[model samples]
Target: MFCASVEQMKSIDRRAITQYGIPGVVLMENAGRGVVTVIEKSFAVGRGAEVLVVCGVGNNGGDGMVVCRHLLRRGASPRCFLVGKKSRMKGDAKTNLHILEKCGIDVVEIEDRIPRQFTRSLGRSVLVVDALFGTGFRGKLKGCALEVVERINRSRLPVVSIDCPSGLNVDTGCVDGSCVEATATVTMCVPKVGLVFYPGRRWVGELWVVDIGVPEQAIAEEGMLTSLLESHDIHMPPRDPAGHKTTFGWVAIVAGSSGLTGAGAMASLACLRCGAGMATLCLPESLNAALEAKLTEVMTYPLPETDAKTLSLNALELMAPVLKKADVVAVGPGLSTHPETEQLVRSLIEKVDLPMVVDADGLNALSGKLRILRRRKAATILTPHPGEMARLTKMGVPEIMANKPGVATRFAGENRVTTVLKGAPTIIASPKGEVLINSTGSSALATAGSGDVLTGVIAGLLAQGLSSTDAAATGVFLHGLAGDIMAERRTEYGVIATDLLESIPEAIELVLGSERGFFEGGVRRVL
Candidate 1:
């Protein structure tokens, strides 16, 4: 599904209203009705339940007015609490608030401060509808608005935030000060960016992106985009029965060190698990035995190793013969970020002709030298969490996490490389200005070596002949699906990177099950 940022939605709204001649208030009514439909499906406003509709002085609260009217019509004695005074409400909100008075539903207007006992009365309320702010809000909540959010949060009440949870940066996904902790957030039109990233994600319990009768072409015109990749936006890898192992492709991985052989092992294993026809690991002669003992499916080549058990200058010379055949190259995963290693990484990045998936120490090698991304002959996919992304982009982790999709999309397009900014809602950006978000994975993936596994997954996909964009997008999706399965079998905290890998086959089977006939041939699994 496509996700449009707030700015795009506004432009589209203007186009529909001014150009197409659709009344703005009519569209708002459609949006409010959609929210009611969603709320009805997810929750039950118990018989005579005290429903509190907390509204601000805006169009979003006008939506709350519609909710109150619907509930009162349902025989529920609901109370309407206008956050601002009656004099402040205008336009449609004023019309709806006045209509509430006519309908005999009491409208209690809070002047300057929210009474201490106001939200406390929420002890008996089954639900609280949050209509404080909309997607246009940039910064944070404050004063009475801020206090009301805190009070509602302290009450442990089930809140249903309209459009988006109040006080979230709709474009960047940042929550500056305070936001409503909603039981579920009902997003109108396309989902805002804040619903997917960290702190905003924390406030929004469950997310449902509802359409409000807007045409798909609206986004096509504005050109603003959000990265929320769904299943349809991907290209599946082709499987030909007439092909040999070489037809799929080969991956040459440069990883492993004296004490860090495990990183290499995980990377190689991930490539094999991701369906690579072959994964060749070029390691220093000293670390060969250890890596060999740890990996089975991956072929190993001995390169020059220094006395320190790391890649030497001679190793770069030896890689000349094998680099020509590799479809994908993995530079660093556990190879320590030493000065000598940085030189080796820079040389390989410049020399390698195949697409590269750089991770861990490989990313560290180029922290201060990000311009190296522009000098690459082949496609480059950099997988970095907020911290590593911060180092590469020269921005803080907070900044990267807040505007992750923007940062990743900007850097990837600027440097002509694909970037996978890893986090909740992992963003995959291609240089062509296309962005895809992975809406999968579990918190259990927060453990060590998980990134090595991820690097492997993407490399393996690249080796299996997927495009740089498809490989990165598919790799992150499958990686997260594996984590989700692992989390289901073993709780979030119990799932490790190895557990993530172990769950891949089942995840693949589950996904492949969706497109059964092609993969299953003439037969089918009864289950």
Candidate 2:
């Protein structure tokens, strides 16, 4: 699903109105009707339902006015509260407000504080429509708007925010102050970046996008590069019916040290579970015996080890034959930060020509040596959490987290490698600056060795002829979906990394079987 920033949405709106000759008021009516559609379908609002419509003196409030008109037509009573001066409303909003006034509806205008009847209004209302702000909203809610949002949140009523939740910064997902916690958000056209990222996502309980008379050409003309990865976007490589073990893919993984041998075992096993035909786990000589016993189906190769029992710099030459025959290579999982091992990782990154999935210490090895990414001829995928990204970019965690898409896009564009910025919602960026926001997983994925499993999944897909971007996006989505399934069966706290390895096939099956997509219906529900 295509997603837009606030400015991009504004441009699309302009193109629809000016270029396509779509009337502004007609778009407002479409938006308001879309909100009603969600309310009727999702909330089951029927006749005689008392709804509260809180609106600001802007185009957003104009939408609320239109909603009031529609609700009245549907035999529901809607009390409209104007949070700003009525004189400030202009354009299509002013026209809608005027139409509501002509219908003998009393629009309560509030400038500063909540009136005495505000509590009584809340007591009688079943649903609250927050049309006080749209995607253009920035900073924090102040004065009466702040109080109104706080009261609406405390009421525990299901809220349907128009366009976006009031007080949300659409550009950054950050909420600086009082923001409405809506039960659902009915966004116009495409989703805003804020609705898909961070704390803002928490405020948006359920997200639904509605077409507000915006033409497809208008949207396509914007040339948006960012997209929300939905179920229908996932495409698995076709399985050959008569294929053998060697026909699928051969993944070579170099991981593990003395005490972290489980990392290598988990990564290699995850590769096979993700449908890789075969896998050979190469670890330090001392750790090979342990992994061989633990991983039954996976093959193991013993590489040269340092004093600390991690893959040593001397192992670089030894991996030549192993890598030469492998379709893809996964490095870093439990490879320790011993100076020799780090050196080995750098050398492999610079010398290896095969597609690579780098994670954990492998990413750590590139902290100050990111220029090596530009020297590689083959595809490279880097999976880094915020802290790891901080180290790789030489930026603070807060800085990277503040603007994940921008940071990931910039890095991928400059380094010419696919970058996966892992977090609550993983962001996958292509070398050409396209960004895909993964919309799966829960806190269940916050377990040890989880990233190792992720590395294996991506490498497994890459070996099967998936592009670096597709492999990262699909891998992150499936990995998160696996985590979600595990969370359902074992609870979020009980799910571990090994549990995810077992759930990969289940996630793939679910995605392949899902029929959900952008159907003919005007509204599309997005999680």
Candidate 3:
């Protein structure tokens, strides 16, 4: 399913009208009707409820006008509050305001010295429709609008936002000014990218992609595709019965040291959980005993170790033999940054000839030396969080977080390495120069040994013969989904890395199973 931004959706909407001959007014009417229909169904207090419709002087305000009219039809008295002077509104918004005035809906011109007074007077309204700003807003809110949102928070009324919450960046999930805290949002046509990620999602609440008669073909014709992977998107047709284990491919992981043995174990387990046909963890000799007991299903090979228990240069010969037979190579989990250990990392990276996913200290070892990956024989995917990405890109963590999608796409294209920038809304940047944002995983996945597990999952996918793009995209999603399930089973703060490792099966089941969250609460329809 396509997850679009306000700008992208607007382009589609415009093309549908201009080229396809659908009038703008008719589209607006359909959009407004969809919002009202969702509101009538979702809001419990209706009919005689006192609904407060807060509208700005824009097309978004126009949507609020339509909502007010529909509420009136439903036998509710809606108190309409127009934020600015009537003369400020234009286009379809002006038309709706005129219709609202003639219909005798009391449109109050709020003369509060500060807009905070307006929200205080709203007193326990059954609903507050936030149509303050729409997609056309290019920056943060200010003055009266900011004041209005703050008091709305204080009023404690359930907010129903039309289109989008006021101050969210639709493309990036970055938050700037005061945003609406809606109980539910009626997103006409497709879901916004912002609603699926954090900070923006923190404000969007429960999202309803209310269809407004926009055909899928029309959206596709405009070439505005935001790839969102539901279970159906990841579903591949069933394989032939004759297919065997080798058909899935093989993955080798070069990871772990004495104290960091847990990282390699977690990753190797993820490889099997994610459906790798053959998976092996090759680690330093000294730690194999503890790791062998910790992990039984995964095959382990012990190599020469240093005094500090990190992999020594002598281990490279042993790793070379394994790398020759492996389809994917996952390196750099729990391999501490000792100089000799970093040298071992550099040698293996330069010589290995398999698809690679380098993560954690593996990333730290190659921090300023990305030129090494440019020399590899097979495909490469770097799974780096913003902190690691900052080290790779020579920028601060704040800068990387602010414009993640843009940075990931540009960097991956430039470096010729598939890059997965990990965090909320994890981004997968392909060597082909395309970027995808993943919506899986919970904040609960922010525990120890998580990155190591991700390295294993991606390696496992690569071993299964998936393209680097598909592996990174699917791996990030699956990793996050596992985190979400584990977090639900154990609260977000309580779920550990091992819990994420354990819940991979549950996440796969939820995706493949019959549960699809639709109308009503809690998504329990078995189909």
Candidate 4:
């Protein structure tokens, strides 16, 4: 599903109303009705269920009014509270306020503060509908609006936010002050970027995108660059039944050192586990025996090593035949930043003709030499956590974290390489400027050697003929799914990176499962 920014969404909404002739009120009604549908199905809202609909003076408030009317029609008791001045309401919002009053549903206006009676009402309410803000909302929650949002949160009721959780910066997901921590957000038209990005994503529990009658052409014409990766987007290429080892794909892994041999082993093993036909661990000549003993199914090639036992600059010449035979190269995991080794990495990055997945030390080698990326002819994927990203771009961690999608997108576009910005929700950006936000994984993935496993996954997928973007996106989703599965089995605290390896196949199967369903046309559940 396409993830739109505030301006793009506004433009899409405008084009839908003006070009496609969709009435604004009809769209508001659809949005409100969609929220009601979610409340009914997700929360089991039924007759006599007391729902507190906290509305503002904007169209968001109008959406809340529609919710109240729908709840009343369903025999549910809904108390509507307007957080701003009723007179300030305009257009569809003003029309909805008058409609609510005519239907005998009293609209309590709170101009200064939330009365003590509102607190008592909160105790009686089964759910709180947060229509006090929308995607256009920015800055902090202040005045009576902040009070109402605080009380709703303190009430501990299942709150459903309309469009966005009040106080959220829909573009950046940064909350300046207090923001409503919703149980679910029923975003209209398309999922917003902030809803998928961090800090803002934390507040949005289950995300359900609802179609508010926006034209498909309007969205397409908008040319949204970012999209939330859905299960359907992961297409595992079919295996040739008669294909042998080399036919599947061969991953030549140039990684490992004396102490960090596990990184290379994990990368090579993950390649095989993720269905790569072969994975050759090309490492320091001295450490080959130990790695050979550890990785039973993986092949080991001893290469010339520096005094520190890291890949020496001499290995670059030896890699010619390895690159000649391999389908893809997985570089950087645990490869120490020894002077000669770093030089070797930079050399291979500039000279290698095969597609590569660069991670850990490999990214470090390119820190001051990123210009080399622009010269590469084949596809290159850089999987960097925020710290690595900061070093590569010479930006602070906070700045990069502030806008992961934007940072990743810019880096990929500038260097013409696929970038996987690894974080809570990984952002995959391609050289073509397309971005994919991964939807799987949990805190359980915060483990050592996890990224090494990811490097292998992507390299394996690339070897299997997946495009750079597809490989990175698919690998990330599957890697996170594996972490999720382990988290479910052993809790987040107990799972490690190696644990994710065993679950990769299961994760792949789960995503490829037949039980998946779409919410509606042009509207899909993104969480």
Q: lDDT of all the models against the reference?
A: 0.79, 0.91, 0.79, 0.91
TM-score of each: 0.90, 0.97, 0.91, 0.97
Candidate 1 per-residue lDDT over residues 1-527, each given as its tens digit: 56677777788888877877777767776666666666666778766888888888888888888778878777776778877877887887778878878998777776688764465557778788888788888776878888888878888878888878888887766788888888888777666666776767788887765555566676567775555655444455777889877777788889988888878888888888877888899887988887777777889988887778888767888888778788789879888876787789888887777789999889888888877789887879999888888888789887776577789999899888889988887899999888887877868889989999999989988888788998999888888889988898888989989887798777667666553122121111110
* Backbone collision tally, model 3: 1
Candidate 4 residue-wise lDDT, 302-348, digit = tens? 99998888999999898787788999999999999898999999999
The collision pairs in model 4 are none
For model 2, the superposed segments whose C-alpha errors exceed 4 Å read none
Report how far residue 377 has shifted in candidate 1, in Å: 2.4
Higher TM-score: candidate 1 or 4?
A: 4
RMSD of 3: 3.3
> Could you tell which candidate, 1 or 2, scores higher by TM-score?
2
